[model samples]
Target: MVQVHIARSGVQLGKYPEADIPVLIGAGTVRRTDHYWKKGMAYWLVIGRTYDPPAAAPPLPAASAKPVPKPMRPLRYECLRCGHKANTVREEKPGNFLMEICTWLANPFVGGLYTITREAGKKALCVNCGSEHMTEEVW
Candidate 1:
């Protein structure tokens, strides 16, 4: 049971069994450029030069065998007032710098909670006319 030391990018990953090295490479855990050192070797050597994957070894299984989900059509938006059509909307929120500073000076704990809740509340506006009145169209 020979053990091999694996290193990559100047950092030692850990020692792994010699037989498992090829399995690691197949699983993407080990790369060809990674360095390895074992007993009887004077210095470290690139794994690509020393190891060759066995031709009889079974190929790695697919990461995901499930069928992929079909792509969804992008949401289309039309501004009711301006009659502008667009696929994107902009988020509108007022800056709370002054309020945040005042709250932080009073109590840092409360200020952090207030800032998080305030930032999470956002209003989406139509990109064309910057109006909140918008209707969604699938097609």
Candidate 2:
């Protein structure tokens, strides 16, 4: 039922329940560099030095073991020009520098939105040969 006080960058944030400190740390709300103090402490200590995480519990044995399923193979493509095999294709999109600069000068938010929308439309190309001509290979 102990409460812990937290401070960051020489500023005291607030006090929280001792049990919740681990959850806060796991969620990245509390940093290792932050200082913490609790009752019966002579001085504040760094959270990383003072904190001791709870041990993990042993896993329970299953009554019956099950067979593991095999993973599905990924689709592969072969470049017609270079005969190169690849599991993935690369995307290509031309950027308009003048429009981007103009929009950015007019409004940064609008420019970002316009860039995202413009970049969304792209053409898939071969990874090795950078060609649109490719044939799917079945194994």
Candidate 3:
């Protein structure tokens, strides 16, 4: 199922009304490209010109311009030192922004796969080591 991320609400709308949503000239979503669709996603919804209310209705409430929460992919990586947990790389789910931090550095992750992080300074060492010399920064 395609996840419909509400950009204004920061909510992940995993459930769609159906397999495909009708996009018009005014609505906020529109199909932008066909490249990924060929990759075998269940569905997709791209944002387009936002639809507004008609003149007959009352003024719409002011909604906070919060960013929507995109779908997150599972990730696993071990620390090179002491064999501990390290940073997680979560891929962007179908029909969402790949730029989201949660979706960054992700590679088509699957279960039962493990790769320890490259060896670095003591700062990158695992918590079990309790190293005194530490430099803070994942990069």
Candidate 4:
């Protein structure tokens, strides 16, 4: 392979393989005004005039092909308190313990249903140690 020396504004950018010249042009690493020369050449010339690179290969046709769907991801989070990874505890509203116990005792079934249905929103609980503060782990 022929080795070509490249220069920009009379400053040398070092020598590179002739085949890489096209790649450098495609990647915008070299400008059309950049100068090129080889051992046999007496002087540098504008790369655009010195080299005639082959045209890029055409992209394949998409004919009747269905796009692949991305896979579903599972929910994962870390407990801020215990640093647990598996399960998360649900956060509950703060209230008087005595009052809450009395209310639960009055109607255990209804209280339990309400407790189950309560929303935690963005907050998560650590299931390992029942911690309320949870940090979500981005996949």
Candidate 5:
């Protein structure tokens, strides 16, 4: 059976697999969440238990496909002075990168009941120039 079963108190996680006869009933503690349960040879009455990882299928061909292609370069720009590279950031159709990220960051809270707060991803920055704009990741 699955180790992580929801319980009444905090949660009643199982220590042994469903295949074995359960004697001890303990809370679903993080340490007991193993894939398999082992029996103890040393302790007869108080024997042992363990967890085993679930079986997974072998990797399929498509699961190993190449990464999506990117452009030779993007709108990412950088500077030569600070070397703090970053991606161009903006919100709405803001005037600059700062405006973009700011908009994205606040959009969630500002959207109110109907709107959602999406993650405003950070663009790559030019470490050499301290610019908060990234071109693409060079091969």
Candidate 6:
């Protein structure tokens, strides 16, 4: 029995028994252009020129892939500071007069723009303690 060493570019892939060569090749892990070396070989040679097999066969079928399930996203906010079930609030702020006036003076088209804000998108104001902070977890 002879041992064969496989390499790609200049990096050695591994040393394996001669029997595994065809399987590795058929499995698509080893390519034809990859270099091969054995005990009697003087130098590394390409697998395509050196390795003689009956005929090229189709690659072994890989195991069927199963879809990975995604993690469930949190639906509600629970206040950490006061331990209260928090509510989600969408807050819109009216345009600031100062900014509006400045923008109006600068350009009327841009002056009418108001700041679109989600002030409490993920944050909750505790009804018990009145502390405004991010919720600890989903309600």
Query: For residues 1-139, could you state the per-residue lDDT of candidate 6 as single tens digits?
Result: 7889999989999888898788788778888999999998899999994555558678989877777878666547655675666455332245455775677789866664432222223334566666665464653
Q: Please, what are the lDDT tens digits per residue for candidate 1 over residues 1-139?
A: 9999999998999999999988888888989999999999999999994666677958888788778888776668878888877777786655577888898889999888778867776666888778988777755
* Candidate 2 residue lDDT tens string, 36-130: 99999999989994565565677878767677777667558878888777778887666776888899899999999878876886666899879
TM-score of each: 0.39, 0.41, 0.14, 0.39, 0.16, 0.37
Which candidate, 1 or 6, would have the higher TM-score against the true structure? 1
Number of the top candidate by lDDT? 1
Q: What ranking of all candidate models by TM-score puts the best one first?
A: 2, 4, 1, 6, 5, 3
Candidate 6 deviant stretches above 4 angstroms: 56-139
Please list the Cα RMSD from the true structure of every candidate, rounded to 1 decimal place.
22.1, 25.7, 32.9, 16.5, 24.4, 18.5
lDDT by residue (tens digit), candidate 5, 55-108 = 467777676678888865543444444543345433232145555456658784
The local distance difference test score of model 3 is 0.35
Give candidate 5 regions above 4 Å deviation.
Answer: 1-118
Report the C-alpha displacement of residue 118, candidate 5, in angstroms.
7.7
Where does candidate 1 stray beyond 4 Å?
Answer: 57-139
TM-score of 4: 0.39
lDDT of 4 by residue, 1-139 (tens): 9999999999999888988888887787877799998989998899984555676679778787787877756557777788777633565554444655666799998666545444322346687777877777764
What are the clash counts of all predictions, listed in order? 0, 0, 7, 3, 35, 0
Task: Give the whole-model CA lDDT for all candidates, comma-separated.
Answer: 0.83, 0.81, 0.35, 0.73, 0.40, 0.69
Q: What's the distance in Å from true for residue 110, model 5?
A: 4.8
- Cα error of candidate 1 at position 105, Å: 99
Q: Which order, best to worst by lDDT?
A: 1, 2, 4, 6, 5, 3
4 against 6, candidate with superior lDDT: 4
